[model samples]
Target: MLVRPSLTPQGAALALAQWWELAGLEIPDLSKVRGGNPETGLTASTIVQSQEPNLTPARLVQGSHHPQVALVQAHRLAAACTSMDALYKALDAFEGCRLKANARTTVFADGRQGASIMVIGDVPGREDDEAGKPFLGPAGGLLDKMLGSIGLYRATNCYMTNLVPWRPPGDRSPTAEEIALCRPFVVRHIELAAPKAILMVGGLTGQTLLNSTDGIMKLRSQTLDYRLGLDAQGASTYAQCVFAPTYLLNRPIEKAAAWQDLKRFAQKISAMGIAI
Candidate 1:
C-alpha cells in the first residue's frame, strides 16, 4: 500500500488554500479551516491517491464531457452497489465534480458501513477534504458528542455519508445544479446501505433529498417520507431530518432544542428494538 505523511496544522492550512485555488472554490477564511476552528487547521499530507489504472487524475482532467455527466455515467455503471467496496469502486471511476480534479484523494464516507443508523450530511469540508473522509473536523467532533448522547457512535452502529461525494469549492453550499448532478449517486448509496433509519443532518441534505424548500427549523423535529430507489422500481424508504451539527455548532443556544429532537430519535429507535 502507498502511505503518505500526515500534515501538521500549518501545513494542512496551506494545502487547503492550494486545493481551493486549483478547484475554483472561494477562500472562505484564508486564515482558518472549515467548521470555523483555528486550532490544528485542516491536514492534507495523509491523503492517498488511488492507484487504479482507469481512475488517474490525468484521465479526470482530460475528459471532454461535463464532469456531472461523467459522474452520472459512473453511477449507472455501478448499478446497485450494496457495500462500501462497491461504492468506492464506482466513485473511483467517477470524474464529475471539479473538486475531484484538484483533491489529493476522494473523500468518501467513513464508519460502520452496515450500521443500522445512518447519518447523511451535505458534503466534505476543508478538514474532510484533506483527510479524505467526511465529518472529521470540529463539526464532526460535535457530531460525535451528539451521537453519544443518543447512545450511538459512528464506529459501532452508524453509517455516515454525504449528499455529494466531493467537497464543494471553498466550502460553499452546493448549487441546485450541482446537487441535481450528484443526486443519483446518493440515491444509489441509500439503496446499498439500506439503513433502518436515516438522519438527514442539515437544511442542504434535508432539502435536497426530501425535495423540500423549507428551512432547517421548519424541516427539523419531524419524520418525512424518504425514498431510496428509482421511480419505476424503488423502495419507499423512511427517514427523519434534524438540524445539522454544523448549524448547532454555529448556534450553540439551539443545542437544547436539537437534543430534544435527538431524544425523540432515540425513543423511536428503542421502540423498534434496533440496537443503538
Candidate 2:
C-alpha cells in the first residue's frame, strides 16, 4: 500500500500560519466584546460578543421613549405578518432594536412547527449566531441532554428560540431595555406556534415573560400562564422557568433542580393529554 505523504515540520508550520491568516483566526477582539479572559484558555476565552457599547459600529438611537416607540412598531410589524416565515422577515427588516445591528445573524427557531413545547432562552451566543439557529454550542449540548432526560428532543416535541434573536456584545446578559424591544417578535412567535407548553431557560426569560424583576430562583418550579389577550378568558399558554443550561454548565450541582423542574414539566405535558 502506498503511504500518504504528510507535510514537513517547516511546511506544516507555514501552512498552519497561512490557514489561520486566511480564516482570520486571531485572539478575540476585546474592543467590541467583554466579560471573558483570554489568558484562561477560552473558557476563559469566549468570542467577543459583537454589541459592546461604544466598541462595535454605532447603533441604538438614544432617546428616552424612542425604544418603546420602536417596540410598538415591532409589534405592529409582527401583527401584520400572517405566518412564521413572514414574521421572521418582518423581524429581519425591523431596524429598531440595537442588538440586531451588530449581531452576526438572526438566530431563529429550530425544531418542529406547532410542537408541544416551545423552549425560549436569552440572546444567542457566538455559536448560535454563527449557525443562525437558537440553542447551540455548550449550552445547547447541555440543553439537548436535559431534554433527553425527560424524553424530549428539539426535533421531536420541542421548538427553540430566543428572547433576543441576536447576541449581545461580549457574551453579556442582555439589558432589560433590549429584552423589551425584542419582546414583540417572540410574542408573535408564540401566538403563531401556539404550543401547549413553554420552557423559559433563564432569569431573563422568566423576568421578561412573567413581567417580574425577580431572579430565576424566585420563579423556578412555578408554572405560570401566558396571557394571550387582555381578557382572562382569552387564549393562554402554560410556561415554566428553569435554570439556564449555560448557567448549569458552570455550576453542575444545579442540574438536580433543573432535572426536577423538567420532570414536573413533563408531568404537566402529560396532564394536558399530550404524550411525551
Candidate 3:
C-alpha cells in the first residue's frame, strides 16, 4: 500500500518532482509555482486564482448561480416595489431562484388582484407552469369548487398566488434555502395586495409564512393573526390564516368540516362589509 503523508506546499512540490522523475520527464522548476504566461514563456505566480467560492454547492454544480443572489437581491427589489405592477415587474427581471431558470415562465399571480380574499398556495404545479399562472391544476379545480361553495370565484371575487412564484423541479417541496430566497417576494405580494383575509394553502405555505412549526391539522380551522409590514413602517398590519384547499383534498372526508370553516371565514368577511 502506498501510504500518503500530510502534504504541505513543500511536500506537494517534492511529490510532484518524484513523480516526474519516475515518469522520465524533465522536472519543471518548483520555485516558479505558476504556469507559463499567456503572452511570454516566462512564468510567475498568478494573482487571480480559482473561481469565486460557491456558498451553495448544489446550485453551483447545477451550472447556475441564480439562487445565490436571490435573498439579498429579492429583498432590495421588493423594498423598491411600491405597487403590485412594480412588484410583478421586478420579479420578472429577477434572475435568481434556480426554479425560475428551469421553469418555462414566471408564474406570478392570477385572478383578481384587488379582491378582498387572497389565496396563497404552496407553489406552482405543472399546469400552473404551462399556463404561467398560480393554481389551475387538479388542486386548483378543487379550490375553485371549494370557493364556489362559499359563493366566491377567482374571476370576480378572489385573488390567488403561491408562496413561490416558480415551480420546484420535479414538483418537489421547496427546500429551506429556496423558501428563504423567495420570502421577500412573498412579503411584498402581501403588502401590495393588502387583502383583508389571507388563505395559506397546505403545510409548507402556512408554516413558512406564519413562522410556525405546528402541523396543518393543529393550525387548521382556527383563525390566527399574521403580522404584515416592517417595523419601520409605523406598525405591522394583521391578517388571518385559513385552511388550504390541498389539505381538504387530502382529507376528502373532512370537506364538510372545511365547509364549516369556510362559512365562518365568509361571515367574518361579510361583517367587514365586503360582498362575497
> Which is the leading candidate under lDDT?
2
TM-score against truth, every candidate: 0.72, 0.75, 0.71
User: Which digits, one per residue and each the tens of the lDDT, describe model 2 over residues 173-257?
Assistant: 7865577667767877887888877889999887776767689998885668776633446677778889998899899998888
lDDT tens digits, residue span 1-276, model 3:
111112222233344445545768664453433343566543221211112143222222333233322343456567678888878888777665777777887788988979878888888888999998987877889888878888888999789888888888898888765776677788779878887677777778777777677887766645665555654333332244556666667778878877776777777777778776
Stretches of candidate 3 exceeding 4 Å from the true structure: 1-69, 232-243
lDDT of each: 0.66, 0.70, 0.66
Candidate 1 lDDT, 215-254, residue by residue in tens: 8888885676565554534455447677878888889999
Q: lDDT ranking from best to worst?
A: 2, 1, 3
Supply candidate 3's per-residue lDDT for 231: 43
Please give the range of 10 consecutive residues that has the lowest summed lDDT in model 3: 1-10
Q: How does model 3 fare in lDDT? A: 0.66
Clashes of each: 0, 4, 0
